[model samples]
Target: MDGEPRTNPDVPRVDDVETWTHSGLQAFLQALFFVLIVRPFVLLFLGLRIRDRGRIPAGRRPFILIANHSSHLDTACLLNLFPIRRLRHLRPVAAADYFERNPFVSKLTRTLFHILPIDRTARRKDASGQTGADPRQRMLAALQAGQSLILFPEGTRGNANEVTRFRSGIAWLAQAMPEVPIVPIYLANLGRALPKGHFVPIPLFVEVRVGEPLLPRGDREEIRAALESAVKKLKDTP
Candidate 1:
């Protein structure tokens, strides 16, 4: 069967804008699509470079993978970086409004990658316009269930691959689950390859730089700056 809703009967689907429940068929299709279609296309055309991948500790089921968000390629490149042994376990946290805006992208995203859709802005500011604190419980739940996540701490797309100030969620995740290491990834030239508001993608070389896994060594703001620094440093590196 195709993908269907799999969740506890009580936690409303609306709240699950950040949950990782997907279809077995879609996962299979995604592997086929990425391996046969996306992989060769990326490798032969826009090359991928993963710097110091060993820094990412092995055998960690539910660590956080945070990176800059310049284009959609940020997540796509990450899915390729993982080895076949751990590919199925990586979950890319996508925005609900963008990825699930329509039927086709929704289906593809859900099926191909085990995605956890999160409300980027709208739900956070409801009718009362009140802001809550660190509303990423679904992510925590996913981690509890042993699912590694590829998250964009920037929360939205940025310009020219510049690393933006991160949201507090990354810091929250690290603090909440100190055992899980937060991997900082630097994706170069993704904006040039397939940037925002572009349909036909250019065949440009892209690099994925993985840094040493970090914990919330400092407070939220300090940790956020450290993560950003890690990514920015890659811009000057080979």
Candidate 2:
């Protein structure tokens, strides 16, 4: 995975005609939910200590938000960074297997978070020997559609305050769309607030350190390593 990539013909390239914008009503409802419900809960309970927020790419310019995952709350916290109006186009990449398993929770997460669910199962060839749909294509489509994305490159949640090795999917995305900047964010104490199994969250403060955007500056391996390093550097920030 060290080299630059080739375009997948199976994946449709985003043209000016293809877009994924929300309707006026949809945007209104999203703002209502975030402001009336989510905002109060976060401020009153999960207090945030944010740093370098000014560095987040502004005004609908498509960008990738890469963060160290520790809990489900990670997505929620990251989503909070944007303004109410931007919530309509914001998408967080989530696991289809888990979030979509239950119909009720699936509806909740989809309508509220606007998650782009990816099938994390092993990609295999069918009886005809055609491979499965590449998850990266879906992410690439979203980016091309001009929607900002939230990605947990660790692939899954880990121990709180711990940065794990990132998979190369992000590298592939960076190479696929080098124009889109990748912003690194480090979140702390979310795992303890809402751990892997529990439901109710503990009132713990979360520290979010946002780093400067990184371009596709190197080969796939170097890009992945550079992403992991940026988040780790944020973790060690004062």
Candidate 3:
């Protein structure tokens, strides 16, 4: 609770239990089964390599993980590299338009992993003419409910090593939930292994670097600048 409350606040409170129980036991079991039994083999077959994973924080506090987007592989790389203890509590903020389009994919995303639908184009009117929920509000609600979120502040994939301008939405979230730590992560060689528009990933050594958690200290711009700096440092490291 850092910033002023919104006029139409949809964010859940810090101690809200409804959000915590949204996904029931079936979801948890499915996620456990996939992560422990299925995902390891798939990652091994893909020749994925994760390094510098010790940087991931060990405690359980709501966190915002901001990373530079390079390819779809970024998600898998980060997921695999995260500490197993934290994996159960992590939720990736995926685009509503993309992942929710298909029923099977949507169910799998929600059940196998805690995937939240973030409307990137929240201001745009849907086919039915109703506006979508504010992305920042949705993200805040997730954080308030004691869940960690992974977001690509760039909004989409871009060239490897190229950090796009950090979006202001991340700044808003940081300010809104100052208690939650903002973690900076970097993925190396993912763009080369599976660049934009390529369906198949080339077998290559992938590297992941997790930087220190960032705390908000100043205004929105200052916090965003700090977050951007941390992410850039991870991207710059060899």
Candidate 4:
């Protein structure tokens, strides 16, 4: 009962853990890249001051991690918070067009970040104009398989210190997976360190505040508002 996935029967499950599980060599490579490269870059180079870390789900349980998107570094910073062992189950939802643009970038992102690519336009169209599988179903399948997700409800990166209007995609996911927890994270100064369209990261101290998991109550608008308010509250935290 402990290891079994708890989800509605309507949600499809990838029967094989192999879908999410990596080979021994692949696992070792991922850990090595994160530990030797990413961890040091996020922690030592950029500097991190984390709060409410205990609020992050202890183990590999299914949850949606919502954060304000201001910089590309936001994902790296959040990914660095978890231990190496949990990295495999932690998938960051990224734009398919950007992350999967080229074969090289796609492979690198898949190896380093294990990103869950989503179509920003929601068209689900490929380069050949063929309709691809629904990104929402991909998310549902991942959740059904006991994986946590990192989602930037703001959708795209914006001005530093400004949290834009949250997209309703999160609300849709929340409605579908009522049993799953939705965690809010407020990132401070990351946008300044690595703002949009910037390459080299500035050496600025970053603050990561984790808030209580949100209760997906009311309609989609109300649920979206609640999640937005939670992240904003974290921004105001001293």
Q: Write the per-residue lDDT of candidate 1 for residues 1-238, one digit (tens) a residue.
A: 0133223242224344444454566567777878887788778777777778777768856788888888877777888877654666787988876787777787677777767766665434643454321337767777877888889888888886477787878777777788888888788888888878987788888888888787767787787778778777876676
Stretches off by above 4 angstroms in model 2 are 1-24, 122-131
What is the overall TM-score of model 3 with all chains considered together?
0.81
Models, CA RMSD each: 5.3, 5.9, 6.1, 7.7
User: Which of 2 and 4 is the better model by lDDT?
Assistant: 4
* TM per prediction: 0.84, 0.87, 0.81, 0.87
Candidate lDDT values, in order: 0.73, 0.80, 0.72, 0.81
Question: How well is each residue in 1-238 modelled by candidate 4, as lDDT tens digits?
Answer: 2234334232223343336445567667889998898889888988898998999888657899999988889998899888899888888988877887777787677777888776675443444355444567777778987888999999889888778889888998899999899999999999899988999989999999999987687799999999998999999986
lDDT score for residue 189 of model 3: 81
Per-residue lDDT of 1-238 in model 2, one digit per residue for the tens?
A: 1132323332233332143345566567668888988888787888887988999988878999999998878888888888887886788988877887777776667777877777665243223354544678778888877788999999998998689999999999999999999999998888989988889999998878999998967899999999999999988876
Candidate 3: residue pairs that collide: none
After aligning candidate 2 to the native by TM-score, how far in Å is the CA of 232 from where it should be?
0.8
**Residue-pair clashes per candidate, as listed?**
2, 0, 0, 0
Error of 4 at 61 (Å): 1.9
lDDT of 3 by residue, 47-138 (tens): 66555566666678778778889988777666665655556677788886787767777766666656777768764544445655677777
Cα shift from native, residue 11, model 3 (Å): 15
